[model samples]
Target: MSVAELRPNMDFWQERVDMAAAFRWTERLNMHEGVANHFSLAVNDDGTQFLMNPNQMHFRRIKASDLLFLDANNPKTLEGPDAPDPTAWGLHGSIHRRCPHARCVMHVHSTHATVLAALADSTLPPIDQNTATFYNRYVVDNQFGGLAFEEEGERCASMMSDPKVKTMIMGNHGVLVIGSSVADTFNRLYYFERAAETYIRALQTGQPLRVLSDEIAEKTAQELEDYPEQDVRHLNELKAILDEEGSNYAS
Candidate 1:
């Protein structure tokens, strides 16, 4: 089919479908804050364009086709038909402009992750095997100066200097995770949330915690390098759960 006759490319459609599924799945995990939070991915090799949900669209109400194809380099992007939320624009647009390595970016205020973010010291403890995935793979930006203004995106971009570090505790805001694709980012986010929840729960118990030794944690982190498709499998399992429950975010 011709470009005018046919729909967008398969890659574009797949990004929409996969991201919508992620939003729905995150909602079920109680990671959504009504209509807040945003996830985006670059549409092409260049970081000029991206795909993200429109403003005010709740996660449960989001569909693949509802996503807006936003051009970060466009002068009139904020005035477009499906304009993005201000914070989304401020944060995502900045990263896309400055951070070429982040193909996909997901920001959320999940319960445990947000709680951890508010802590005076925003470091994830290597207390368990799950937490080890982020061993020496995160950056804690201590400067929380109100909402993420337009200028703030560039600052966040600067802090994300390492491509290998997928996780970023956005000061007092929340958590941001990036990956080469939506599936990879979502998988990391899910595991990161789990790790945060585990540590927070242990803190609540008021008992002595069993923290992993640095040598063991470092070894586990290295072993995790072999699981290149770990995120793919984890996402498939979540999709299966949605299928069993009749949530048609993919459809």
Candidate 2:
């Protein structure tokens, strides 16, 4: 559809479509494990309520309008046919309630992230540009006292307060990334998983891993200020690949 011809509500529908697309894309990329992963996006401008995948649907089966609209302030989820998973409630609900700046939150337990999380030292070494994308903008939450619940989620909110840190390594759990949009979150999540995989594999090689100096790593990360436009191109390319394979993603 032509940009000029798009409706005023296009952004709303597009957000839903893209949110659904992120879930399906994660599954296709092997980034989801059953119904474990949770992805959320704040709705409207004030960022009170958010969009999240329904309680039990596998990532592949998610549809645009099928998402649940949840209120962050209300402790009890609105009476609905599709309640969100309890863990999702614990993780995303706390974020939405506590982190107003976190408009979009993504949590996943993909192979690489889980692998890195399992490490005694789950810190990502600045090995390359991709690994350097986070630089000081990532946190290692070493204290994983079971799933995020009650005080635990509140603990997460405190630990995840830095605006610069787009991603967090929930030690012994998985990865969490926040963005202004699903495209941004997914892009960061994708690169983070790949970067972690690269970091771990390089360590396995047993060669002295070349680590970038903090100054250079910070510089490289600053260069990623261009990533908003860069990420649009990247996400479009990935979307095209998925479209070629199947168009069921946003339906």
Candidate 3:
């Protein structure tokens, strides 16, 4: 039968559609590594049960029906036929298990973000409005363990304990962002890369950087946080464009 007929009562269909759209758009923006990055969203209370991308799948080809349902509390998750990537399971799984506030988590090794991560300091300063949006709202993880196995995942998860910190600059690695929903997290991830790009380009200019004041940066951050429905609208508009192009992301 057809794909829809195979799964008649797909749970969290809208969430899955939004996530698939995010994946497609991220790939279009060249923010995804070669079948490496992963995105996840919590579906149950306490955030232990979640949905994640299938193992080694390219973001551009992901569909709503392809997400993997998993539980952080389940020991046999990795033994199943539909098991996720080890590092995805380790990092996203650990975050969901420990940080209930992080309902949605996205991890990617996008170029500019990874470049910032490779720096000794690995901090995103408030240089412009986009950069200011993340002022005092992110954590820097200097500890770069080899691959994100269970131990490394747990260690990284611990750094996200603070609800105020929505982004993590994974030193010598990549970037991880968490939010209450797919749109929120994806929007944060998108802007973060843009901000990193601006900062990196500024450094390349070798000119004096005009940094925003702490007061103004904090104010701008608060304003953006209070700005209503920007994240939701952002994703919705993207989905609209995808629909116009007859993309199969939602299928």
How high is each candidate's TM-score? Answer: 0.91, 0.91, 0.97
lDDT of 3 by residue, 1-251 (tens): 55456457998888899999999999999999989999999999999999999999999999999999999999999998889999999999999999999999999999999999999988888999999999999999998998998899999999999999999999999999999999999999999999999999999999999999999999999999999999999999999999899998988
Q: Cα RMSD (Å) per model?
A: 2.8, 2.5, 2.2
Sort every candidate by lDDT, greatest first: 3, 1, 2
Better of 1 and 2 by lDDT: 1
* 1 or 3, greater by lDDT: 3
**What residue runs in model 2 are displaced by over 4 Å at the alpha carbon?**
1-11
- Model 2, residue 230: displacement in angstroms? 1.5
Winner by TM-score: 3
lDDT tens digits by residue: candidate 1, 33-133: 88988999998787768999889899998877788888788868888677788878988988888777889999999989999999998898899888987
Q: Backbone clashes in each candidate structure, one number apiece? A: 0, 1, 0
User: Which pairs of residues clash in candidate 2, taking residues 3 or more apart in a chain or in different chains?
Assistant: 137-165
The local distance difference test score of model 1 is 0.84
Off by over 4 Å in 1: 1-11, 244-246
